[model samples]
Target: MKNELNRNYSEVTEFILLGFRTSPEVQIPLFLLFLLIYMVIVAGNISMLVVIKTDSRLHTPMYFFLRNLSYLDLCYSTVIAPKTLATFLSRGKQISYNGCATQFFFFALFIGTEGFLLAVMAYDRFSAIRSPFLYTVCMSQKACVRLVIGSYICGCINSMIQTGFTFSLRFCGENRLDHFFCDVPALIKISCVDTFVNEIILFILSALIIITTTAVILVSYAYILSTVLKIPSTCGRNKTFSTCSSHITVVSLFYGTVFFMYAQPGAISSPEKSKIIAVFYTLIIPMLNPLIYSLRNREVKNAVKRILFRKKSFH
Candidate 1:
């Protein structure tokens, strides 16, 4: 009974998200733009997933990682984009407190998962490029599956820890969140209780994740570059460089937005400023992912062509 009473009084049922600004001029344009972007992101990621799933040619370790990345994009967008779109349309942009926390929890989950998965992808590339003779042995079907699973598992655990800490914070006053989504920094700013410990924990965790993932990616690319340079055939070197370039571009975009948004202290990282940067990772990147990979990859293009031809024949 004591625990129930404390829970009932302690928990906040709702929160107001200040959402960019309250002007009609801004809201309409923002809404339309985000809606279009959301559609494109969903369409692009889904197309990639479908292409990978149906095509026999794409049943390789690389495409498997790409498929997982696409899936993560879908999950990541779903966590924030719909709510953001709704907030734009609504005059009163209020979300239930539980709802806000829930959103943040899932958002953190996928963001962390993507980071780890990207690192795994980097290692996969490293193995492929640096150890061609042992590449198949190193990245076997069982190993790839385990690596992907491990990334997600680690992400889930990390998110749970972060969310638990975030929820323990007290927010009795100023319920308005400065950002569009229920981000940790925005939420922490409005907490009525002490937030020093929470902020430190979050900061340390964020640093660990970004630092570890970036280090792995950088090291992998270094070895990859060395191996590519050692190729005796110019054509082979060119092909290897081309393949790694797309992955590197995607990884750079992902980590760049992440570092800009979360890797700094709140004193330095402005919520308003970060929100703009956040759009790249949240909306634009997902839409661009399929285009970057598909256009660059001959195998994906051929699969797409075959699929289109099959549709024409059926008609």
Candidate 2:
């Protein structure tokens, strides 16, 4: 009987995504605002990719990892945002059972990959600052590629586990997901059977990924700080610190919301808070990332300037 409950047959073919219980007055404006954010997210990320690809001077392990970050943000946002925009316009806001699972799968995969990449970027910064003499050998092009591949593999494994676990449960009762997107917690809320196992799995996985990656960032920065302190000149230390500042900003914005969304207990208590947190990470972060890097990263700013100047000169 216990085994049968885990595989409980789904009477619900489709789920009504009860996206934001907003008044009719606010719906269109909200939809338009989100639409604009999505446009910026798409354009800004593509611009970053283009700038990275064209500038030979910007070709390095740092920029390479950065390119992947842009791509990751672009993708995961696509998975969540468009559907969300559609949900706002849609009175039905209905998604198929399979569709919800697919959304969660891709979201988990890209997001997990991104978390690991940030850690890798932190370590790259560490290597450069700690061993300037051996930086090239330590972070060879081959090594960067290997690290990226490993991140994706880890992401895929994580996605498969969570997606399989969430969808395998028998969703025999309520089909209304209280959130805009198909998140694990929202899905678990509607499950007919006991979600103790699922809750344990969710807690364990989120903890492991969050803890391990955050540890890497903390350790890498500690070493980086130690090295930077040894630099004789204030200007040199400032320059080194400036390079890391953008990454810190991006990490704080992403991890803060994610930490709240998953690891925190308050998140489960209030569905509205969870949706707002989702908006920040899924919509706002993607849009802000390129702008953050461009404003803070001298190399990226210079690259943009060179591109614009060439275009101006051509005309």
Candidate 3:
């Protein structure tokens, strides 16, 4: 009876995140593992940013976008990693109502902005490869700055709408959120009122952003593929393909998971499965991004070597 009174929308003040439902013995292991992963996520992204900023050779539009990508990855992981780490160690996984809103807003902002930025990178690749002579004029530094600013602005506006859309609903129901973080689908699932309209609007807005960004990538790559096929020499073809390979790889990783989570209907059918997938894209992907770029891209490797040699010379 007392619980029922406290759970009403007027009275509810916090949410308890039910993290992973694994066995008790695994909690410590998971905690340790996530803590290490979070550390790597921070270190890797910061290193990427530092390398890009210091290396004069990396001062191109491509690396400019890459720099922002690392920044977003860092911000995205930090938003959830601390809270997630807390859930594993402590019994109290309670988050205030405002805290959840802040988390959702920032998460949505970075994720949304990153998606748009990838499309811009794709456009960058397309221009460089398809029209080398015009590439400089097309992707001039000032133009690149505007493009990035526009992406963030779009993300911020959409984030506000999505955040307001989700949090405006009454939560006179269960306070135990199934997932480790506050996400659109998860919050929608727990609303006390009729969420049919809210779900549609949210899904539509999310889909609009995903689909629009994806279209830019697809169209850009299609042109790129055609242009690449026309190159006569084998070595030339290989070089052209290599230029955009890292961008395409990251694009595939990001879009694949995002599409599965948001685009598909009835995604919340298996909460455990959703959580596992969420762990991959949200936490694991950020850690892998720096490694992916540094390992696969020849220029990044060269830059790291140059920086190390310079530091050694200084010492």
Candidates ranked by lDDT: 2, 3, 1
Best by lDDT: 2
Full-model lDDT for every candidate: 0.85, 0.91, 0.88
Candidate 1 lDDT over 1-315, as tens digits, reads 012233334446678777777578889899999999999888889999999999998898988999999999999988999999999988788999889879988988998999999999899889988788998899999999999999999899889998898888876646778888888888877776677887788878889999998899999999889888888999999898888888888998998888877777853248778788778888788888888888988888999999999999999
Q: Write the per-residue lDDT of candidate 3 for residues 10-64, one digit (tens) a residue.
A: 6457888998988889999999999999999999999999999999999999999
Report the C-alpha displacement of residue 137, candidate 1, in angstroms. 2.2
TM-score, prediction 1: 0.94
lDDT of 3 at 205: 78
- Cα RMSD of all models vs. native, in order, equals 3.9, 2.3, 2.5
* Clashes in predicted model 1: 1
Q: Which digits, one per residue and each the tens of the lDDT, describe model 2 over residues 1-315?
A: 233463456577889999989898899999999999999999999999999999999899999999999999999999999899998888899999999999999999999999999999999998898888999999999999999999999999999999999999778757899999999888887888788898888888888999999999999999888888998999999999999999999999988988988886667668999999999988899999999999999999999999999999999
Ranking by TM-score: 2, 3, 1
True-structure lDDT of candidate 3: 0.88
Candidate 1: misplaced stretches above 4 Å?
Answer: 1-11, 266-269
lDDT of 3 at 225: 94
Off by over 4 Å in 3: 1-10
